[model samples]
Target: MFKLGLLIILAAIVVCAQSIPFLEESNTVAECLASNNITQAEFQELIERSSEEDDLENTERRYKCFVHCLAKKGNLLDSNGYLDVEKIDQIEPLTEDLREVLYDCKKMHDDEQYLCEYAFKMVTCLTDNLEQSDEVTEAEKNTNKLNE
Candidate 1:
């Protein structure tokens, strides 16, 4: 309920239709990390440092990669390696949508056709591979047997 609403808001914020507020609002690495969610602070700091370089295009490219890496790692609701089941539940919908946004950002940043194609393939592979992991397979088999 409340969690679902929070996820909807987060998805709206992350979508291509919406801008990344962290880039627009934050002035420092700390600020950016705080704004995006402290769970991603380390990666945000890395992006901030990369942006200090003179090349704006390079900065954007790196930032896109940073976002992709964050998404690949998982949702932002948990912190300090402790899973807050409540927070995790709250952000599940947003995390799912973030995966899509990260994939798109990776595609846009990948100038070389090879990297773009590779990333697209990687997206498919990660999603399918994750779904077929042992735990998920066992759960699915249990469900199928139950239904039968």
Candidate 2:
């Protein structure tokens, strides 16, 4: 239950409605949750807990599997249980920089043997990169404005 919630929260953090189309679909999330045997209440609780700093590292294996389920459903994972970089590059809202980061993250985890851990690590990598990317972009914009 906790893992399910953590996966959902991680998904939300890395790919909110503006970025990932599948995540915006309630049916998809519901299906993944049901398949994973995670109760809606537990999912909600985990989402709330996601705001805490330590949830990601403490997330359970079930939650990692839940993330894998979501990745499969979203067509983010290839037949080998690795991220499909080609498909990810086609996502309309993802900027080239973000796509590059995704590719790098995938490469970093290429040795993962478990699909669940792979998916979870991918999410974690994405969240960390996205946050850093946002900070960098904001800083660049501020610098550009000052220079102008």
Candidate 3:
């Protein structure tokens, strides 16, 4: 069941990614740019003007590297090339749904682990789930107000 659920959600993320390709670009790209003494915004400017396919591919690779940079820097990635769930729990207040999302996202991994893709996918999944939780919390508050 969990595998099926993760597959569905990952498919959805990929579909959305097709429409906005840059949404697939993880923070790792930004981290990689720092080596060139470039800021995230500067990298964005550079990528935006690039028209060559090789350039895009190169940038994608850089983005992947950036993701690794972020995970390593934040201690988010474990030695196994997977997310350190313990570190995440220590750093963030995640609800049950968010934890589930994280678990599901984490299940999609390669031998190399592609921590950049994992981190970005996990980050986006968590952000979406957390926003839903916030909405539900706000709705509950409104309901309580009405009852009172």
Candidate 4:
């Protein structure tokens, strides 16, 4: 949950979304990865380096692709733009509404149009679409704060 939240926060840096508090409050890549007992500072450095040369749009796309690559390889997310709830359940079971949003976001996301903007864009949509009763997850709450 927090990993994906961190992804959106990191993505805001490439896109420079100032209105959102996510960027300000999120854990650094180094800190966030520690929670999972993973160590890969080089990955964050690589992503930062990739952002240095491109325009915002292209850089955003690169970041999305970078995230997509990680999620795909790690099996944390599916190509349909849904979080792998089963895999997440292996760690801990999530609420039903969180599951609904995951599937709904999967159906709503368009990889062709967004080109793998699932971490940020899809989560944003999911949070916005879910009502208060849906019991949005922590990641969804963070993502919902994204403006436009």
Model 4 ranges off by over 4 Å: 1-7, 10-59, 79-82, 110-115, 118-120, 127-148
Best candidate according to TM-score: 2
Q: Which is superior by lDDT, 1 or 4?
A: 4
Q: Runs in model 1 with CA error above 4 Å?
A: 1-113, 134-148
TM-score on alpha carbons, each prediction: 0.22, 0.80, 0.52, 0.41
After TM-score superposition, what is the CA distance of residue 23 in candidate 3 from its true location, in Å?
Answer: 23
Cα RMSD for candidates in order: 15.4, 3.8, 10.8, 11.6
TM-score of 1: 0.22
Candidate that scores best on lDDT: 2
**Model 3 Cα lDDT, one tens digit per residue, 23-112:** 345553344458536576755564454432232223354444554555565556677767666666666555566567667666754344
Per-residue lDDT tens digits of candidate 1, residues 47-122?
3554344332222333333233333233332233211233433444335544554445444433434332333333
Give candidate 1's whole-model lDDT: 0.37
Ranking by lDDT: 2, 3, 4, 1
lDDT for 125 in candidate 3 is 55
List the pairs of residues colliding in candidate 4.
none
In candidate 1, which residue pairs get closer than 3 Å at backbone N, Cα or C atoms, i.e. clash?
Answer: none
- lDDT values of the candidates? 0.37, 0.72, 0.51, 0.48
Question: Distance from true position, residue 146, model 2, in Å?
Answer: 4.2
Tell me how many clashing residue pairs each candidate has: 0, 1, 2, 0
